[model samples]
Each structure stands twice: as structure tokens, then as C-alpha cells.
Target chain A: MTGPRYTPLVAALPATVPFIGPETQERARGRPFAARLGANENVFGPSPRAIEAMAQAAREVWMYGDPENHDLRHALAAHHGVGADNVVVGEGIDGLLGYLVRMLIAPGDAVATSEGAYPTFNFHVAGFGGVLHKVPYKGDHEDPDALITRAAETGAKLIYLANPDNPMGSWHDAATIARMIKAVPEGALLVLDEAYVDLAPAGTAPAITPEDPRVIRMRTFSKGYGMAGARVGYAIGSAPLIEGFNKIRNHFGMSRIAQAGALAALADQAWLAEVQTRVAEARDRIAAIVRANGLAPLPSATNFVTIDCGGDGAFARRVLAELIARDIFVRMPFVAPHDRCIRVSAGRAEDLAAFEAALPAALDAARRSAG
Target chain B: MTGPRYTPLVAALPATVPFIGPETQERARGRPFAARLGANENVFGPSPRAIEAMAQAAREVWMYGDPENHDLRHALAAHHGVGADNVVVGEGIDGLLGYLVRMLIAPGDAVATSEGAYPTFNFHVAGFGGVLHKVPYKGDHEDPDALITRAAETGAKLIYLANPDNPMGSWHDAATIARMIKAVPEGALLVLDEAYVDLAPAGTAPAITPEDPRVIRMRTFSKGYGMAGARVGYAIGSAPLIEGFNKIRNHFGMSRIAQAGALAALADQAWLAEVQTRVAEARDRIAAIVRANGLAPLPSATNFVTIDCGGDGAFARRVLAELIARDIFVRMPFVAPHDRCIRVSAGRAEDLAAFEAALPAALDAARRSAG
Candidate 1:
């Protein structure tokens, strides 16, 4: 019998996942990492109240989660000072990105993003057969002007930008982002992925303009709120745009535990502050460690630091391999110039200490191998 | 500025969600449900061990769930006696169906299902712009023969069937299902949703054909495992079809607590058996209440009972409205014939008692309205 007939797009797509989990690497290594720092997850953990709320909700797991995600959306609306109609809750930023792309992108739709930006966004665009026009990062930060220009040039439907971006914890100032928002071409909508904005400095994210139909800002509970495993994320946009999600989203996709945890987490801003403090401390420590090891740590506004390895991609890959061998789980960028750096997450003291201890030996091994 | 440009498919789609949540209903009525039996969720709840596991996993919410879902997949494979490569886990059957449709159905591709089958499936088909060919249910059951014929005639890429079906609680025997599987037309795949199979009688499910490319069977923790809010469902099919999910699925969509809860729920088979027993008893209790009210209760192999109101769809709709007026959350089928009945979940004794107390008045109100 013939196998399932995949759509031409799917048949041509590669079988590669966006990110491999640290757990998979641990399993393959036959041992867990001494310092789990890959994938940019908040290693500081979630609020105690969030955990308690999830525990309480676990007993009621028999009922389907509110299909409308009623309470969370309202709370988020109040939090963001937007109408409830201006927000939509999703399983996570990843899931939200997928849904958003599906809503705006048909086959051969033009989409644009930085060449080394979030691969997950690219994955979604390609999944929908959207032709991507890539703009390379300028000086390690996402060049907002370049992206807007590319969007206008390509007549793209969606353009993605992450403030305090992944792989390189560089960010654009609020004024720059606001300027970029204003410059979005008539036909294109900007997908401002603020997944790391929670961990960024106060001036990093642009002021909220919920009715600005030109941009939809994505926020998540995964970073500064320290609840990545909860899979709770939201989008803030104009009412009509937000309502469009109802036409397609898996309305019952959010777990009850996620809703409760995120609700509790949102209520505990003090806990978020605490996480921010911890993350800031961890970032400084990571930067110091990188400097001590003779690598240049890039200025970071998010929960991680990207260390310029002072070498090419091949040299950085060797360093990465050596670090993995030394049980220090870390990642680097995918494209050139940016790939010259290794990205490290802001882990707790002991976790960072493991990375600190392993780095010198890893560097030595990489150097020896290069020679 | 013009609002976000929606794909033509999304723009053409209605804002109607597949199901309006009970929570939304509660909010609209300004009161909580007295007995929430509308959604067919297991009121008996998840296994204690599953709750315990979720509670434990809550502390680790800072980390993303494993993208590969290795441990859970291995366990599911072991449970089903299938190779791990034959299984694909998802947020829920709803989310999986969306991904599956996106993978196999380009715009205007043909898909077939019974008219008034699962609306969420229809929602996904429309979301992907799949042209659907529908056949009428025969005697309140999904007619497999007609569905296959339609698929053959339409050259549909996907055909859907649900055993121990939703809304009407009707089912075909295992032998009939096997015969139907063999009848699936060339270039078409059968989506056999067994969402409620754990509550169905033994010998109701066909024997495993893990390598068979023509049929993909969906199973969930939402029913007998009593974890609907956990949002975990898996598909078992040929290795290639299962792997195709990697192309477009939210790879890290599953929550860590969800993975943990489902794994624990699966291990405690005794709890599943216990839930099955409770569901059977509750079904009988519901049937008795229906008979006492002079309504006709359909035979059910699933967790809910559908009672014919002895009138047309409008009469059943009035009964539904009256029940809602009394704070009893229940549902009715959206299609004719089946729409002549109101479906109620197999709630616990106390929940059923609330329904029993409310049903007489509800019936009286409906009759008065009908008159």
C-alpha cells in the first residue's frame, strides 16, 4: 500500500526540528550536563506561587482548559492596559508563531526576517510555503531599518524581529523599535517577537500601542516569569487582528495547569523582579567568566550572553564540541559573523560555576585541535 | 494603516469556534455550572500518581519540555506494542489534526468525513483550505462504506472516522472497522479517532497494524485517563507518516507537566480500569434518569449518553436551552437526526444527581415552549 500523500510543500520540507532539547543531548551523551544552559531557558525556575497554583490545578486536569482562555486573556489585558479584545493566549510563543504565520501566509507568500534570527519563525514561514527574504544582522543586532526596507521591497506579509534577540542577546532601544514600527510598509505587518523583552531593560521594548495594526507584539511567560515548561504565551494586537486567531487556533490547546500557573505568575511581579535580579547577576557572572577566559562577551539585554570566540565558525564549532565533551551545554549562532560567538544562558551560581570551570579546558582543547 | 492582512482562507472563514467553552457559558450566564457535563470530560479526574507527577514537574517549569518527547514516546510505543518510530505525540488530537491537514492538504485538496462529525476536524480542514466532501451519518452512526466511497469519488487525501463516536456515543464493531480500513481508497488515509476508546467495550478496537500506511489511529489521555486539561494525544501509524509531523508541528509544544502527567497516567492502568468502571456506571445512571423522564436513551459504548427528545432538532435545542437556563451544562449534535438528541457526559454520582434534579423542570420548560 502507498504511504500517506504529503502536500507538495511538506514533501519537499526537511525533517529537521527547530531546536533539539538539552534532554536529548543528555540522553545521547549517556549523562546529564553538569551545567544545563542550552536553548535559552530560564534556569532560575518559576515563582513558588506559580508552582503551587499548577499543583492545585493538576487535580482538576479532567476538565478541558477554557477553550477561550478567558481568564488569562483578561488578566493579560489588564496587565498590558489593553482591551480583552486586543489579546490572544496561546500554547507558547512557538505555537503562537505557527498560528500567526498560518493566518497571514498562503503558498508563495513573501516573508522577511534577519538571516540569523529565530529559526522557528523561518520554520513556520517555510511550512506555509512562504518565500523568505533574509536581511543579515548588522553589527550583531537585528537592523530594524534593513528589515523594514526588505519587507517593503519584497511586499512581505510578515516581518519578524526579536528585541534582546536569541543567539545574540543584543537589543534595539525602544525609540528604534518605535521608529521601525512606524516605518512598516503599507502591505506588511511586523511580527515583533518580544519573547525576551521581559528580561530586557526598561527602555528596550517600545511603548505599547495595542491598536497599531502594523505590528503584533508577542510576549511569553517562559523567560522573565520563569515558566517555560508551562507553555503559556500571548499576542497583543488590534481587536480585529486578535479576533482572527479564533478562526484557526486550537481553542482548547492550552493546559489548565499552564493557565493557572501563568495567572499566578502574572500576579507575582515581585517574583518576576526577583528572577530579573537573578538573571542580571547570572549575566554579569557569565560575562566575567568569558572575559576571564579571554573571549569578548557581547553587551546583553536578555537572560543570556553571547561571547565572541575571536575565531571563525569552524573554530567556534570545535570550542562547542570541546565544551560538550567537558559537559558544559551551550550553543552558538547559525550564520556567519554571528556564528563566531558562543551563546551561554544565565544559570545559577553552581551551574555557571561548572561552565566557568569547564571553559578554560574546552578552550585549550579547541586551540590544540586547531593547531 | 490597514489591519493585518489575513490569508484569503482565513478571511473567508467565520469567527465561530468549534466549541464554546463551559467557562465562557458560565461567564455569559453570570453563574458557574451546577453540573458541567457538556464537554464529555471524565469527572472522576486523572490518577493520583499523575497529579503527583505534574505537581513535582511544576518546579521545573523554567525548562522547556523535551522537543523530541523521547521518554513518553518510548513508553507509548511499549504500551501499544509498536515501534517508537510509529508514534507521534501532540498537544491534543485537535492540534495533531491541524498539523496533519497542513502536511497533506494543499489549498482545495479533497477531504471526506461524515456530516456533523467532529467540528474541530472540520475547523482544521477549513483552516488549511481543504475542500471537504461530506456524507450523512447512517442511522446515527458514521457510515464507513459511504465515507470511503466519497473519498474514492472525490479523490480525497484524507477521510475521517471516529469509533465510539462523539455526540451520539455510537460505534462500529472492531471487525467492521477493520473491513472499513481495507476499503480505504488509494491515495487516501483514514483518520481513525479513538478518543473515547478506553471507555469502550473490549473487542471494540481493531488489532494493531502499525506498519499500515492507510490508517492512523488517534488515542488520547483525555477520556479514560481523565486528563483532558493536560492536552496530550498521540497518533500511531506507519513510521513515515508519523515522522511527517516533524515538518510543521510545534516541536516543543507539549508542556513538561503534560508529558509527566501522561506518562504517570499511562503507568497506572489500574486507574484507567477504575475510570472505565465509573464511566460505565455513570452511563447506566444517566440512561436510567433519561428513561424515568420518558426520553429515549441511545445505547452507548462511550463515556456519555445521548437521549432522544422524541421530537425534531428544534425540540432538542429547546431542551438544551432549558437545561442551560437551569445551570446544567450539556450539548446537542449540530446535524439532523443526531440533532434530535441531547448529549450528557457520564458525570460522577453527585454531578448526575444535579442533572437529575434539573432535568424534570428542564423537560417541562422545553415542552411548554414546544407547545
Candidate 2:
């Protein structure tokens, strides 16, 4: 019997996930990964103070979180020198992206992004029935010029750019991004995803004023703050755009414990500094390991290092599969040219040692499989 | 100075919150609420096991929660004697409702619900640009037959009914609900929100099978489990309908700590039983208090009691405002007839004591102001 009918757009969309989580793989393989570095999660963990705050808040879960996300929003506003009205906190950047797309994109609207950028963003665009125009990467990094050109050509309403781009771990400096922001076509909102900016080198974030209505900057506690599972992310934009989120967002969606943890995490700058330093060390170790294994590690400004596999997309896939099979979780790019490399996140010394040990065998297995 | 343009529907929609949280009122009044009975939160709190589980999961927040929500979904399936595919969990019932509406309601699609049922449900339908047909409540209860008739007349894509309804603590029996389910119009889905069913009397819940494609039941950890702040809710329905959530849901949205807490909370059925008992006792106390103040307390089968103010909506409005001014947070229904009552949630003894202490003064203030 026929059940309720899905909306035309929803009916046309595929039932797919952007990324198969490492846990799903672990379940399928009947074992946990030896070194969990694939998803780029910060293994150093959130600040001890943040964990303590969450534990304390656990006993208070009977009450729904502040619908306004009052304290956290004010703190973030003060941190960024923006008014609280200029900041909007959500379940995550992914959730915010969905809301943003729904707010702007009617069916058949145009959106633009790099060919193989964050799939979750593309997923949102598609979910909202936005027609996506994909621009190719220039060398190892997303080409802002090409993306802007494509947006102008297609009359795209939104242009998504992730600073310190994922998959390749490449970044554009602040001045470069500032120039790109200037070049953005009129009427197109620039969505600057700064999920990795906390792990990027200085000057990676442009000094855009919060009242600039042309761009919305997304930041998350998921990466450098080491609270991905806490699912807290905020967007900084003009007051009108930020206020628009309240129209359609699940206003009471934030988890109370997550809010408390994020507040504490934001307050603990010393812990963040320590984690950054450790991440740097881990990156160096990962690079050395990759070089020793006959792969060239790409220059990275984020928590993960992308290494050129010295082959094509198929070869990189095989390498990734080999690593997964060897109990060393890793991932690679999704499109051509960029897929010639595999991405590995910075981890603890023991985790890196496990990765180091598994790399050679994984490479051997991949080579054997290719032959 | 123009920003990105919003879709026509979003442009037309007002940025409004359905409920003004007690916290926002506290901020405005510069004082905390003396007794929080406005929102139907279980002040008794979650199970000790849930708190411990959340605390334990706090340290693991660095990792993203499983995209599949495998363990929790499977556990819920086993608990309900349904297959895992019959269940889909989300950020909360609010989040899930948004997704469900988006999935089913195209712009201009017809939806049906009681005029002042759950405003949040109405909010979602409006957010999705659905045309909503409102039927008046039959007496104090949601008229299932009227809702069904309206759904058929309007060819509604979805019909929403909350068993053990909110704002007015009234409910219909299982046999009536079963008849309503059978009478749901073809191509229309019935959304059964059971947020308070855990506290309802035995035989109140209809014995609907999970495989029933015509209806989807929403359940949450926010009420009986005392985890409103945790933000976990699930929908149980036919596998096909449940699988549709994967097409548009924020796959990585669930909070890790919340997931762990809900799992532990579900396992501790003893805790749920005790909560039900406490809530029933609290409801009785609230009714006694209401009757003592020369108001009529409606018979309740939920966690709150709606007390008729023995006047008009205007009088009830004054009573509600007086309670708020007195730092006793209580809410009233939004429509006529029903609006002649104030809804107070079941709270701890101390909280209720504060409500009892303030009610006479609030009534006095209302009477004097009306004069």
C-alpha cells in the first residue's frame, strides 16, 4: 500500500551519508581501529575543565537548554567583538548549513562550491533542491578565483569555501581570502567555513567585520576544542542574517551539557594552546612517517596531513582501504587529481606509532593488490 | 549594502519563537523563576544511571557520535519488539518533526491539527510552507474524529495528534485512537506525539504495531526520562517511512553524551516507573492546590494539570501574567475556551510549595487589575 508521499525534492534525493563514520566500519569489521585518525577528530580530547563542566551539567538535564543559547552566544559575541545578535549557535556547522540553505535556496536556485569540497555542504544544497555548480581545485587547494567566477557565471546565491580546506589540508592566508571575499559576485553570500581555522597557522582567518552582511563565518568546537560529539557550532554574520536563523531553526535543539562544555572549552585558552602544540608535533611525526614510506606529505595548516600517494584516485582508494583493513583508519579525497592523496589526522604518540607501523604494511598490501 | 536574498517563503515567514522560555523571562525580570512550571519539565531529574552515563561519556566527546546511531537504534528496536529499521532517532522530537514536515510537506501542501494543539508542530508546517487546516478542540481534548474529518476534507499530507495532549491535560482512550488511526485519509500520514504517554494511565496507549505505515509515533527522553536538556527523540513507524529520514536528516547531529544517557535511561525502567509515580503525585498536588484557590482542576492523565480559571480568556491571561510577575512561571493555552485555564507542570515538592504560596496573591492581583 502507498504511504504518505514525500515532497518532490525529498523523493528525488538519495538516501546516502556524506561519510561513513569509523564506527560503522568498526562494526562491520568486528573490531575497533588501532589508530582512529580518519575523521580528523582531536584525540587529545576537550579541556579537562570542559569535561568537568559537562559532568556537572549532566545532573541538570531535566530542564531544556536555554532556547536563546544566551550565555554561550554572548560569550562568543564578546570573543569575536560582535554583538550577540550577530552570532547564532546551532547543533553543528552541518545543521547550520542545512538551515542556511533552506532559508536562501528555493527549488532550482544556484549554489557553488569546489568540485570535491565538503560533501555535507553539497548534501545540504541538494537537500534544499539547489542546483550546485562545482569548480575544480587549483593545484592542491580550492581555487577561490574559479569558485567566484563560477558563481558569477551561474548567478549562484551562495558560495561555500572552507578555509584550511579539508581532504588536502591546504589553506589560503587571510589576505588571499580577503581578496576573494572582495571578488565575490554581488548578491552571492560567501559562506566561510572555519572549522579547521583553530588548527591553522596565524593569519589564516581574515579580519572581516561581523556586520559585513556579505559573508557568514562558521566556527565549531568539534575540531581544535576537541568536542565533536558535543555537536556545537556557531555562525557569525550580520544581525539580520543571524536573526533569520530563529525563524526556522529548532530553537531548543542545543543539548544543555554540550552548551556547558563548550562554554568551559571556550574559556580554557591554555588547554587549547597545549593541544595546538601537541597537534603540531603529531603532524610532524605523521609527515616523517609518510616520507619514510615513500609518500610525499602535502603542506598542511590543519589538524590533518594529506600525503600524495604518487598515483591516481584508484591507487589512493586502494591505499585507504588497505589502511582500514590494517586497523589504521584513514581517508582520502573524493574527486580526481586531489584523490591522488590520502588524509591522516594528527594523533597521540602511541596512535601515531600504530599508524607508523601499519603504514608500511598497508602500502605493501596496496602495491600487491594493484599489481 | 544588500545581503543574499531569502527564498520567497522564508521572506514571508516571521522570525518567531513558539514558546518564550523561563530563562528569557528570568533575564528580563532580573530574577530566577521561583517555581518553574511553565514548561512541562520533570524536575525530579533523569535516572542516576543516566547522569552517570552522561558524565562517563563526557570525556569521549572528542569523537563524533555514530552517524547511524546503531547501538541506540537497535536497543530501541529490541525494546519495542520492532526491527531496527523501524526506528530513527534525532536531536529531539522537535528536530524530528522539522525533518518529517520537510520530507512530507511541499510548499502549499495541506496539513491538519487542532487549532492550538502543539504550536511547535504548526511552526514546522508553516516553516515548510505547508497550508495548515485547524480544527477546534472537542471540549478540552484534541478531537481525533474532527482532525480525521478535516484531513480528509483538505486532503492533508499529515495530521498531527498528541495523545495525553499538552496545554490542556486531556486524553482520549485507546479504542477511540485506534478508530481514528483506521479512519486516517489515504495518502495522509498520522503523526502521533506521545511525549507524555509514559505518565498516562494504563490502556491509554493504543497497541499500534511498528510496521503500521499509516502512522508514526514520536517518543522522547525529555519527559518521563527527565532528559529534556539531553535532546534525544525517536520516531517509530514502517521501515520505509523510517528509512526516509536518512534522505534529509543531519546524519551526525546526535550528541554523544545525550546518546549514552538515553541508552542508560531506557535500560533503567525502574527509574521511569518511579518518575511516573512522582509525576502522578505531583499532578494530584497541583489539582488540590488549584481547587483550594477556587479554580477547577481538569482531570489529568499527564505530567501537568490544566486549571479552569472560572472566567474568560482575559481573566486567565491576567492570572498567568500575575504568576509570572510573582516569579512563579506558569503557562496558559493560546486559544479561546481552552485559554480560560492555566497549565502548571508537575514539579518537586518545594517548587509546588512555592506555586501554592504565590497562587492566592496572583489571583488577588488578577482580580484587582481586572477591576
The CA lDDT of each predicted structure is: 0.92, 0.93
The lDDT of model 2 is 0.93
Note the residue pairs that clash in candidate 1. none
**Candidate 2 — which pairs collide?**
none
* Cα lDDT of model 2 by residue, A246-297, tens digit: 9999999999999999999999999999999999999999999999998999
Report the CAPRI category for model 1: high
Model 1 Cα lDDT, one tens digit per residue, B1-371: 88678898889989878999999899999999899999999999989999999999999889899988899999999999999999999999998998899888888899999988999999899888899999999998999999999999999999999998988899999999999999998889999999999999998899989999999999999988999999999999999999999988999999999999999999999999998899999999999999999999999989899999999999999999999999899999999988999999999889999999999999999999888
TM-scores for all predictions:
0.99, 0.99
Which parts of model 1 have CA positions greater than 4 angstroms off?
Answer: none
lDDT of 2 at B165: 94
Instruction: List model 1 lDDT by residue over A1-371, tens digit each.
Output: 78678988899999889888889899989998898887788988888999999999999999999988889999999998999999999989999999899899888999989999999999999988899999999998999989999998889999999997888999989999999999999968999999999889999988889999999999999988989998999999988899998888998999999999999999999989999999999999998999998999999989899999999999999999999999989998999989999999999999999998999999999999998
For candidate 2 chain B, the 10 contiguous residues with the lowest summed lDDT are B204-213
Q: For all the predictions, what are the DockQ values?
A: 0.87, 0.89
Error of 2 at A284 (Å): 0.4
Pick the lDDT winner: 2
